[model samples]
Target: MCDEKQLQTWAKDTLSRREFGAFSGAAALAACTPGEANGTDANTSEASGDVTESSVSFETEDGTMDAFFVHPSGGPSPAVIFWPDIASIREAKRNMARRLAGEGYAVLVVNPYYRDVAGEQFADFAAWIAADGFDAESGFALVAPWREKLDADAIGRDTAAIVEWLDGQDAVDTSRGVGAEGYCMGGPFTVWSTAAVPERVKAAASFHGGGLVRGDDPKSPHNMLDQAQAEYLIAVAQDDDAAAPDDKAAFAEAAEAAGRPAVVEVYEGDHGWTVPDSPAYAQAAAEKAFADKLELYARAL
Candidate 1:
């Protein structure tokens, strides 16, 4: 794992050197026209649109891991397990979970990087990514090589464990099964988790996910469509298609060939549009995406 202090320093220096315009150029191009907020607010009447927030830890192969848990106060809600982007679990993601819970679902947002750190020290993670730059080559060089030390496999396995735990919880309705959603790196992780325990996941969605297909292996996450027991949705950013057109097609084609119920939508936004804290957040796109995701969970779970 990268040293937290060193990562912070690198991030700060990288941000300092880059002009803000350079970082936000794509976002500026994809900005949504102002409008009313369609989703429930985080700070409203507690019962009407409130979600209880707490922390829970579970044992993984690496060790114990911490995660943010959000759910409704009443009986047995359908559960949704969410994974964060490369920055790991942050306030934005926790808020996302709460909003989903407000919509009447129990949500668990886990820290995939929990092998090394605790909750929401994203500035450090962001600094690491910023200094390293967001590219596959750089990711492998700086990030992927550290996977073993952080027990990356535990991310998928622990997700399955959470599903089992949710099944036993009085607050969750295991009969309906669960839904899984992820963004960016969490996107592929979500699919992998579904494959890990398909019997418990009724729906899976990935937004602007990376690494669906691996060059070195033909049986990557993208090829696991045949193994999915749940309905699937893939939201691809317009810009991302330009870079990984082949992988996107492969994912779609594989799903189709397997006769799975899947829908691939190309949204008019940038890669991080679904995340409000991201530089590329497009309110219009995010709202539509969230609604679509909720509908999928409602039908499948």
Candidate 2:
């Protein structure tokens, strides 16, 4: 069923880190540009031209939270809260949300680090890595303190607030159900969101997310599956899977125990492959992941 109900990886990882970095830098430079990376360009889809975007903020328990919201001019569509990766919200995220809006969904891409920062911390994924000296130790140093502030419990609260705010929007179709999608660290946020607002969020997708099934962490997202009312689409990167070969099965078993339908697949790509701005971007695999995402939303939301 991996080829049917579940999606499959599209291609092999042929690019070395250096080759991948070079290719992604060139591709992302163009793709991250406003109005260029859109999957539904103006000349391509009329819906693309119809999308309206705005920078928005609201009161969460923490503080004033800022976000980018976009949706078709058409009123009342199913809402999707997008949790960006560690790099946070930037041009790439705004463009991504717009493309999804053109597909007939109200998309809100959030700044996960709202407590420490209100806006873009780095220009892009590459910029974030470089700003911290580009090595694992240095990179970890920069995000460590920031990550500490957003524990699983804090994320659960944020998701609740985000959903409540979204429900009040004229663009959101509360009559239907909501969807949530997350990347990298945001991946587990999808699960957390579902557990937080299970009644509203009927579907969720996680791409190349980290620490979903941490053996040492008793309260891992895997353990919270039973709290969700949503079906799931968990796409693991090849490299991440290699590091923890047991996570895929662990997730599957948890979903079965929860009695929720899911599509859990390990794709042939490195971590961050699904996000175009990342040096790890793998076009073929990313496309497959996005296609599966569309399918999951169409059926669930």
Candidate 3:
């Protein structure tokens, strides 16, 4: 089990200042550039054994959220909505989207913190998380002000909007249900989105997601799982289990009791192992976890 001090120390070292600066700089460039106007056009061009990339913005409860969408350039394809970690939309997530597109899936990567900033705003966020030590308390503290500005409800609504938008695209297959994947805070947000619109999401995966189970409030987002219909895959870091063992157990039990398809896999890595930008990233573990994720999507979506 990791104490607050130990956790804080790990977070500090894991979220290095140097890496944060590089991410921040890249985010600034993405924010400044204009995204492709027509998602279909981008995908159609890629369908001929090519890869295409574009960006689009959608209306969320908080405000407008922009996303980088990619896929093969031809016709409607299976869709996957990816939710990024707390660091916001970085190169790793974008690359992942393109890779999925190359695999013949239309991928949409949404900026969960869109309400807080216009485009990529990782630099500001990195500074804040760095100051706060990247712990739960600090995480909430950083997002608190954005609560009224962003609201938890925006998660589901924004995700729904993205799904709707994707379905309308010529590059997406609306008849086939979509899949959702998220990391860190985005992980829980993905689960919330899937539950909010069960009919649309066929598969949902959460990687090192925080708040899967509530610690204090009975009416927390974790309580929303009763409405989930999608098959779920949860990947937990060994250290995170130490902080929320009961919550994790309760979630698994709830899934079983509800007769829902769900599986929880513990990876032998730190909390941010799946994130390439994080200091805690474990390449071997991340590769294995990502393989598991792709397999789940293949079978469920």
Tens-digit per-residue lDDT, 1-301, candidate 2:
0110011111113444354446545766554435534432222223445777777889898887888888888688999999998778876777777778878899988888898888778766655654554443444467668778887788888888999999999989999889999998889889888988889999999998877886656568888888889999999988778777888999899899989998999998888778777766777888789889999999999
Tell me, by TM-score, which candidate is best: 2
Reference-based lDDT, residue 211, model 3: 68
- Worst lDDT run of 10 residues, candidate 3, spans 36-45
**Model 1 per-residue lDDT tens digits across residues 99-131:** 788788888888776766676654423333554
What candidate 2 gets wrong by more than 4 Å, as runs, is 1-25, 29-48, 216-218
- The deviation in Å at residue 24 for candidate 3 is 11
Per-residue accuracy of model 3 over 147-171 as CA lDDT, tens digit each: 4443346677787788878888898
Q: Positional deviation of 78 in candidate 3, in angstroms?
A: 1.5
Q: How well does model 1 score by local distance difference test?
A: 0.68
Clashing pairs in 2: none
Give me the displacement of residue 202 in model 3, in angstroms. Answer: 1.3
* lDDT-superior candidate, 1 or 3: 3
The global C-alpha lDDT for each of the candidates, from Candidate 1 onward, is 0.68, 0.77, 0.69
Q: How many backbone clashes does candidate 2 have?
A: 0
